[model samples]
Target: MNITISTFMKIAVTVIVISALLFSVGYQMVVDESNHYDSELDRYKNESLGR
Candidate 1:
């Protein structure tokens, strides 16, 4: 029983760590995409304004 519990705990911890890493990577990608979009928009706006 103790061995099983230990194995379960290890698996749970590994899953949690992997999940957290994936979430962070996904969030960073979203943020980078947003920033890129904003910059492109600004560039277009400046061109329209003849800046």
Candidate 2:
């Protein structure tokens, strides 16, 4: 395969796209986990309201 400027650009673009996708997925997972923890904390707080 010939390594031209276009090839280099394509490779760079692919790497960037994959990196962005991974970051987005990881960020969303973190958000979901944080939300779950928050909900649990809220439930615990409500349960102890009368204490």
Best by TM-score: 1
Best by lDDT: 1
Report every candidate's CA lDDT: 1.00, 0.94
Candidate 2 global CA lDDT score: 0.94
Point out where model 2 deviates above 4 Å.
1-3
**Model 1: per-residue lDDT, tens digit, 1-51?**
999999999999999999999999999999999999999999999999999
- Evaluated at residue 31, the lDDT of candidate 1 is 100
In model 1, where do residues sit more than 4 Å from their true spots?
none
* Candidate 2 least-lDDT 10 residues: 1-10
Q: In candidate 1, how many clashes are counted?
A: 0
In order of appearance, the predictions have TM-scores of 0.96, 0.86
